[model samples]
Target: MKYRIVEQTRPGGMLAQVYREVLVPAFPPEELESEESLAETLETGLGSLLVAVDDTGRPAAAAFGHWWEASRVQMLANLAVKPGTRGHGLGGRLLRDAVDAWRERYDPCLIVAEIESPDARMVHEDYGDPRRRLGFYESAGARVLDLPYFQPGIGGASRRVQGMLLLVIHADPTFTPERLDRLSGKLLRAFITEYLAAAEGEPANDWDAKALFRAFDREGGIPMGRWGTRP
Candidate 1:
């Protein structure tokens, strides 16, 4: 499969179908960003758009990642495979390719993903099983962090993003616990406030720790991978 950069920079192609037919149906209302927000995000220069194409030139899978310059990392924001293309390992291939691309461009120390927590508590439509999702990332060398991270609300929406698991794959062998803690905060702020839900007159995610702590309650700094949660 050929990987192409599908952003607002280059339009009038398969991106429309990928977003509408593939992503819109794949993600729930809260998780899926509106089309306008997506285009605006791509215009910000801090994020990217990537699509994996088939032999016939159809867009098979697509993903997006937002850049955190301070930590030099990329947050794998959204990844979705076309309905008919699921279970062929396309999701895994797309993720691996995106990680390689990020490393080639930025040499980031880590790649971050926030997934549904592995416990059977929270659920969603279509892709509701948390372990199934986390297991996929684990197979790709990603570990489910024990951090109790919370995703801030999306844009003006009031729905809270709950039951999150922070999954990270690191490139830096020299990373100390202190460094990882610092990295986590930076990424959360960038992705939560600046990119995903920056509303008018509101403080960035950095300034909202009190609110965040109350909202998400992710204070413990456990760094261990929850391998025991795997099926």
Candidate 2:
């Protein structure tokens, strides 16, 4: 089904409704950002929201991305489809729309996303299977970066979520092994620095954030690989 794609750079309108109905229920509390934070990003021109509205004007999927000036990257903060709208490629369509929009607007050096690592070694996770989700992103041309990743608390009642993997969904000048290896540490450190400051107030204060920054600050070039196949 062809859905209308809407771009929102500010709060109110369908943004709030979609956050309440689609995102709130689709993601776990710790994984989702507070509505206020989401709004603030949009209001401040740091982020944008793309919604796939069905024929009846109901949002079927949503993708939120924020631009990190320090890293020249656009982070795919969240990509979700309504429970009933899954398996129809709505999420992929929304993701593509987001990439296109961000590319045209920011021309970011890289478009990244945080995903649940399939190696998390858990069977009863609240969200769906990590393996399937990993497959979804990989099929979309995403390459997983080798980094010890964990999400900082998103404020409100949210806590940090660990065992996550960062993916480069899109990159400019494309990605050569040399470039990937050389910039892995530099890019990740900057990305997380900005991300941590936004979500946790102080990047150096959060243990996981600080550890990640330090670990990747001067680390060697990291390899990129597909799921179940990392070098």
Candidate 3:
């Protein structure tokens, strides 16, 4: 079960294999970034790609995410373990490590995750069970942000995916839910605005982005919710 972390890109490296073998099969097209897009993100230094390689030198898991400087947010875009390698805690280990690495590199204030809602319609059988995925993230210390959430389309012919859950993990070691039940609405607005702008090329121009932004903007602060509940 030993694993070593390796950074990769799309230039026919191990990352290419991971995109083909793990990411492509794990995520629906709408949620998964195109390999070229991922590569560009890495190349441009806007994204980080980490692969967990087994002792046999095979990739067992992958984590890809971006650092949003405007909001000091770390966006964990995708974390997937190879299908047959589940139940051994590989996914959780990789998640923790990925967040730690990003923290050292970017010093983000918040860690954000975009997950499919457990109550939403399944994108496909291969997308896996949303409940199980939420459980995994919750067990790893992520809490859902209570907000009307939707993922902006990856452009092209893709459509926006709604009923998504926005999860957050506090960077402060002493942070507790008892101390604060909600996050700053202004900060959330910044994150959402930047995220939308990044995804849609212009946040104000995209209907879904505008609505999502307003959801956070109108709130003084956003309350946190349990993972399995609807937003």
Candidate 4:
């Protein structure tokens, strides 16, 4: 099947509808912004969003990333495929395009993605086991940098038993110590606010690059980089 990447906008865009009707249905409303709000956020230029259309010109998958200036990193915020279109590698194709688009503008751009940890309570209760989701990214060279953390919702109300896996992919071959530091810092911050702080119980409120680096360094299940590295 043919594929083409389009910006988040277009008349009756499939990306917009899918986000509203499909992805949101599986998660708490407070946990994510509504499709209309997301569309507005994307239009503000704080990030980039894209949708993939199959040969029939129907939207099949979508992904988006927000720029973190403090760490000079790009945080991949959302990725989803149309329900029946999954398992066809459309998600990976969309991700490839997102990475390539970022590389054109930023050298050695560090990419970060967050997935639900396998044992998370939310996953078990709401989404069922997360092995398939985790496995998909792991096969894509994503490494889990930290234990699952809580994801905060509206008005300081938090979702309990929710944890996230932080995965990093460094694109710049000339990545320097300084660049790594910045990228790592951003990842840590993201982990704290996005995952750690939102957790229930007495989870640690602080983390640093060294801590995250050590976490991933000790684990070796997934291939570290590139598509062919796995399998």
Candidate 5:
């Protein structure tokens, strides 16, 4: 089947509707209505919206990214795919395209994502489970940054426990040590203030960055591939 990523405002924006109404419903109660109010939440000057379509032109999956310029990072948001169409690897394709688009427009940028803890454990457990979403990203050379924090909802409602992952795909390894340090500092601050800060009320941001760094620092760095692989 054919696959393409399109803006959410295209002629068939109904694809977004299908994802919100159909795909999101399959999430647990806690996540059921999360995207319902995204229209306003996602209205931003620097974020990108993407929808994937099947050969018949049906919407198969969708994802978005919010650009954090100070950190030279793009935080991936709202990734979802229709249940029936999930196992075919469309998710990975869509994600790769998203990364490609990011590189095309904003090269030398870092790709980041914060997923819930349960989702992470589930991904680690599944055998060839299409939900093993992180693997595709790891294979694409994304690094896992284990920032154990929760993501807050509007008005500081409830917090969703999330862990952050980073993919420095297009980084300029030639940058000076000082420049890299500055960039890393900015990214870390944004990760705290924007993502981790939003989740403040639910739980204390008790996880130390140094501890997380040691945990995720390795030869391959947390095995972003299939679950059966050695960590």
Candidate 6:
């Protein structure tokens, strides 16, 4: 029952058994990435991965991410554990190990991930337990963002009510107005914009008008330097 967390910087290596046998079977359709598209992104340094393998050398769990090089931020593209490996704490261990390595190696400003908000009204809550996912992230010390957020419908009609909330953890929590803006507009939006655009076969842009607007609306853009005070 030995397990080891390993980094897989190349797509071909991680995407082989982990992508097909583990990740594909674990995520639902909307959350799943198209293999070709994901592989392309991986090869281009737009994505990264960390996997946990069992004693038998079979992958037990993984964390997939979309990384923005300029600002040093990563989006938790996906995280999953093999079906038979559930309840063994492998998922959390794998995530913690990856986060530790990323912080020590890359020193990213922050790592952000989106999880479905349990707004009982959304149909997606029934499909996936938002509460369960949130709890897992919270246990890992990830902050639950209060700001409005949404994930673009992947290969489907618009789904604005799915209530996707951004869960972010900072390498350092201190914030200045400039840092806040970077976190809000420059960093967060960059990853989100790329994530959605990738699915649509489009390109990532400035991210201010399109994705940011959709997440925060026009008149009131992200409140600068007010991350922790707002309700």
Report, for every candidate in turn, its global Cα lDDT versus the true structure.
Answer: 0.63, 0.78, 0.78, 0.56, 0.52, 0.65
- What's the distance in Å from true for residue 1, model 6? 2.3
Give the higher-lDDT candidate: 1 or 4. 1
**Model 3 per-residue lDDT at 79:** 91
Those runs of model 2 whose alpha carbons end farther than 4 Å from true positions after fitting are: 121-126, 156-158, 174-182, 205-211, 217-220
Flag the better candidate by TM-score, 2 or 4: 2
Tens-digit lDDT track of model 2 for 138-210: 9999988776777777761146788888888887654344664344666666777777777776545645555
lDDT of 1 at 201: 33
Query: What are the runs in model 6 whose C-alpha is more than 4 Å off?
Result: 120-128, 154-161, 174-230
Index of the highest-lDDT prediction: 2
lDDT tens digits, residue span 1-231, model 3? 798988753344786888888899999888988888887877777788889998998888889988787888888999998877887888888898888888888888788899998887766666778888888888887888877788776773146778898888654433333346667777777777777767766545555556666766544457776765535
Query: Which pairs of residues collide in model 3?
Result: none
**lDDT ranking of the models:** 2, 3, 6, 1, 4, 5
Summarize candidate 1's per-residue lDDT along 68-176 as a digit string, tens digits: 6655657787888876667778888788777877777777766778777776454454554567777788888776655445555666434546667667765454433
Model 1, stretches more than 4 Å misplaced?
A: 1-12, 120-125, 177-201, 204-222, 227-231
Per-residue lDDT for 188 in model 1?
A: 46
Candidate 3 wrongly placed segments (more than 4 Å): 8-12, 123-125, 156-158, 171-179, 205-210, 218-220, 228-231
- The stretch of ten residues in a row with the least summed lDDT in candidate 1 is 213-222
Candidate 5, residues 1-231: lDDT per residue as tens digits?
A: 787778652323454575555446444444323443344435545656687867877777777666666556676755677766766887777888887887777764466665443245443221223335566655766554433334444345343433534434334443213433222433454444554443344422444534544443333223332224323
Clash-forming residue pairs, model 6: none
Instruction: Give model 5 RMSD, 1 decimal.
Output: 5.9
CA error at residue 101 for candidate 4, angstroms: 1.1
Total clashing pairs for each candidate: 0, 1, 0, 5, 0, 0
lDDT of 6 at 10: 67
How far is 188's C-alpha from truth in model 6 (Å)? 3.3
